[model samples]
Target: NPLMQPNAIEKISYGIDEAVKATGLGRTFLYERMASGELKSIKVGGRRLIRVADLMDFLQNAANQRIS
Candidate 1:
């Protein structure tokens, strides 16, 4: 089922909901991280979206943090 999950790779960014699912984080937690700058996002017109590269970077940094 994990492999079947859609990654939405056709786009450069993802909306908040997609991010929450991909990251397995609660909505509040994700929003909090966004506010704290742990996770980066961009506002386009009226919607907030996270870049694919940024998400990967965030996970990598999180892994590094745990290792250290």
Candidate 2:
């Protein structure tokens, strides 16, 4: 059942390194977006993790912007 969920919903959150890998963006770029409030993330202990849903939404929004 673990593999049955859509990738978008499968993951709860991803650390900065995983987020950068998943988004194909540089660490600095993601950090900047996090600081700018353009992207949403949660602090788990001392680590900041981006929600999978938020990451997907951000990518979709970026695509829509390019099409516009």
User: Whose TM-score is greatest here?
Assistant: 2
Model 2 residue runs over 4 Å out of place are: 1-9
lDDT of 2 by residue, 1-68 (tens): 55665554466789999998887999999888889988898998999999999988888888999999
lDDT of each: 0.88, 0.87
What lDDT would candidate 1 get against the real structure? 0.88
Instruction: Show where candidate 1 strays beyond 4 Å.
Output: 1-9
Candidate 1, RMSD to the unseen true structure: 3.5
Clashing pairs in 1: none
lDDT of 1 at 36: 96
